[model samples]
Target: MTVNYEKLRRRFYLRLDAVFSVEELNKLRFEYLSSKSGLVRGALAALIQQGVEAEQLSMWTGLLKECNLALARRLEFIRERESNEKLTAEAVDVSYPARPFKVGLKHPLVRVIEDTRKILTSLGLEHVDGPEVEDEYHVFDALNTPAHHPSRQMQDSFYLSEVGKLLRTHTSSVQIRAMEEREPPFYIFSLGKVYRNDWDATHTPMFHQVEVLCVDVDINMSHMRYCVGFFLENLFGCAKMRMRPSYFPFTEPSAEIDIRRQDGKWLEVMGCGMVHPNVLQNVGISPDKYRGFAFGAGLERLAVLRYDIHDLRSLYSNDLRWKVS
Candidate 1:
């Protein structure tokens, strides 16, 4: 059987010229150029069986090459045109507004912590840290907290199975650790999470606290008073603050510090007082030679008061609509 190379070439170009879409061109290319079942391949196979002359075989090869080149060129042209059309249809106008995108913000609690750290650190206090999971010694006994204290009760605190290990109820434990590691005439602050068996709008099982300790010669309540007032003034911008006598196992004369709100109501913000002689003695510091003051504040409470947030629980809600500013 004689293969009509001229007829095949004419058929290929006729179909190629009629191809209007990339899909149609691809189909046409496969029909004529496929190695396994294409018209060109079948015709070549037939020539192999029929023993076509070398001259005729060379001619068939040249025709096949021309057809393949033409198909590729057509495909490239169609693809380029399609790309341009898509770009034109989807072009953006320079005068149009951009689509809005959301960005994350720092949480209110974190803001309060940083602000407090900045103010206290400026007062010569070095920042320190301690473990959230602490032993009974540092968390309680070393801090002069008696065994019968309410905070030692399981209902008020979280205790572990290790007999003496438990979640720290306050950053005060860090102060004890610092005092044991350093000598007097030093100032340090600890900021991190503390846990208690507590849950309410203003209280969570886990919350952030910043505890400051300054142990130096002649350090008294007056120095503490000035430091506390300076911190509150810088933090809240000229807010009314008052200190009233209170009680804490770690301090000789404990006082609860309060800040007045816009509504003229006083809200307790933190607790402070002179370091107890027992507490200093437990840390191997001489109470007779040196006295200091320590204070602890809740990060969440400070944020709530500063931002005028009504419910403290909302700080932890993680709702996107909740404005930290």
Candidate 2:
């Protein structure tokens, strides 16, 4: 049987011209070049099996081989064309202006806490932290806070659903935790958030505090006063400060330190005194063997004074307009 090589070549080129996709090209390849039923390959095999003359066989084989090469070259051309179309469709324009991005500043309270931490840490005190969710034993009872103290009440404090558990009212609890974990003669300071049931221009339900503690033999009020004074001078610029007698459950002879502002008005800033013997004893330290001093200041209060922020609530209002140093 004679093969019509001219007709086969024409049919292949006709199919190739109509192929608009890689999928259609693949189907055309399978129809003409596959070994099982391919028109070109099967016809060549049939001519050989029928014992055709050597010259005729050579002509048919050569035609089939040329058809295979033509299909391969067409496949490469189609692939290159599709790739260029995709690149054109997905091209990005570099000439357009970049989108505007808004950057943010740190909150005033955080700045105050970080500044205070650096100052206290420079004064030979190590930084420590504790959990925000705490038990009554650490937050109040271990600090020598009396059972009837106003801070233990739900109206003044936040109590969790679990009995005797509450969100700490101050970072003073961190000091209690530090004392319980280590035998002190240790100097440390802590900074973190505290919760209370109050909110106003000067007060917020949640605020930050930095508390410092020093425990060793003969750690007197003078040491406490000097440390507080140095911190205030460095923070607020050498203002005349006075210590007014105040009371706290954890400190004996507690005084609220006040600094004379530039306007000649005294603003109360922090509370400090020698650690109460009961507080030392509660933490398993003997009062006779060691005495210490502790001080705590609200970050919001100091930030307000430093930045001249009018309202404490503004620090938490998420208002981007209020800028601070």
Candidate 3:
């Protein structure tokens, strides 16, 4: 039942010397020093349990305790060396040129919508939101679109049911809804995706539009003209605005807004006019007391003009190449 002290110490040193990592050192330490089945610990316990002479037990115990401290110090040294080697291996050079990384950019359409909102907001216009699938009353009746308006026709609209609920064709519906909720002596703007059964090089079934409505006692066509001019100047840095006689069911003197391109081409950008009495009355606002203006412009048209994109469909393709270009 006597412990072989010399043999146990030699075997422990052999195991410790083979450890080259902190994890390996930890395993080695546990094998020899753990209380239950540890080689050194078990040997010491066996010597005491088997009733060794006091002097012999004291000498052996003292020697083993010294060896245990030496083992621990050695393990600590190994741990430090392992850590230093890892640090050296993984060190980064601060002066070295960094690897290039790709960064995502905002979509051109999003940029257009954000810029449009920013410009109108700066002009004291409040931005508002409404539902995409809208009621017929808000989408048409509230906006003074007569029952026969081209936009409401089966060929143009995406009617959901016979009850007259469908995807809004323009942000104008949002403006109408906003007016109904509050009495206005204020300017409001709404921007979001609208839908219709239309598509071509210059059109899409789903597209974005920014709608503006200004309601006040003295709101006039001159105020709307200045607004159109101001918005174009700030948005596209466009100059040379031209307004012509146009018609909308909701406006008294509707004009299709056009901006003069550098190529001397007059590009129609938006529609604006004095709010009609009927549209005002439909929203419970008196026409004589609250005359104002409303304008709506396609965000895709702005993106096309701003980025000089040749095809309107490119904006909706979600193709990285088109966006990057």
Residue 206, model 1: Cα distance from true site in angstroms = 0.1
For residues 47-74, what per-residue lDDT tens digits would candidate 3 score against the true structure?
7888878876776677568767877787
List pairs with backbone clashes in candidate 1.
none
| Per-residue lDDT of model 1, residues 160-241, tens digit only | 9998999999999888888898988898999999998988888988889888899998999999999999899998886589
Model 2: how far residue 31 lies from native, Å? 64
* Model 3 bad stretches (over 4 Å): 1-97
How close to the true structure is residue 130 of candidate 1, measured as C-alpha lDDT?
84
Q: What is the C-alpha RMSD of each candidate to the true structure, in Å?
A: 8.1, 11.2, 9.9
lDDT of predicted model 3: 0.85
lDDT tens string, model 2, 12-42?
A: 8888888777788888888988999888888
Native-referenced Cα lDDT, model 1: 0.88
Clashing pairs in model 2?
none
Model 3 alpha-carbon miss at residue 257, Å: 0.9
* Order by TM-score, highest first: 1, 3, 2
How many pairs collide in each candidate, listed in order? 0, 0, 0
Model 2 whole-model lDDT (C-alpha atoms): 0.88
